[model samples]
Target: MSGGEAYVFAAYLALFVAVLGWLVIHAFKIARLSRELAELVELARRRDGKAPAPDAAEARVAGQ
Candidate 1:
C-alpha cells in the first residue's frame, strides 16, 4: 500500500478503537449506577421497615 493509504487506514482504525472504548466505558458507568440504585433501594426498604415497592425503586433511581 502507498504511504497515504496506510495513514488513512491507521486513522480509521484509531477512530474505531476510540469509539469502542467509549462504549465500554459507558456500559461500565451504567452498571455501576444500577448497583448504586439497588443499594439505595435496600436502604430505603430498611428505613421504611417494609418490602420495597416497584414505584419506590423507580423513584430512587430517578433521584427523587
Candidate 2:
C-alpha cells in the first residue's frame, strides 16, 4: 500500500477510537446523573413524610 493510503487509514482509525471514547464517557456521566436524581427523589419523599411509591415504570406495569 502507498504511504498516503496508510496515513488515511490511520487517521480514520484514530477518529473512530476518539468517537468510541467519547460515547463511553457520556454513558458514564448519564449513569452517574441517574443515580443522583434517584437519591434526590428519595430525599424529597422523606422530607414530605410520604411513603415511597412504586417507580413510574413499575406502577405502569402494575396498573396493566
Best by lDDT: 1
lDDT of 1: 0.84
What lDDT is reached at residue 63 by model 1? 76
TM-score of each: 0.71, 0.72
Error of 1 at 40 (Å): 0.2
Worst 10 residues of 2 by lDDT: 54-63
lDDT per residue as tens, model 1, 1-64 = 9999999999999999999999999989987887788788788787989876767676666673
Assess the local accuracy of residue 47 in candidate 1 as a C-alpha lDDT between 0 and 100.
93
Off by over 4 Å in 2: 1-4, 57-64
Model 2: residue 12 alpha-carbon error in angstroms: 0.2
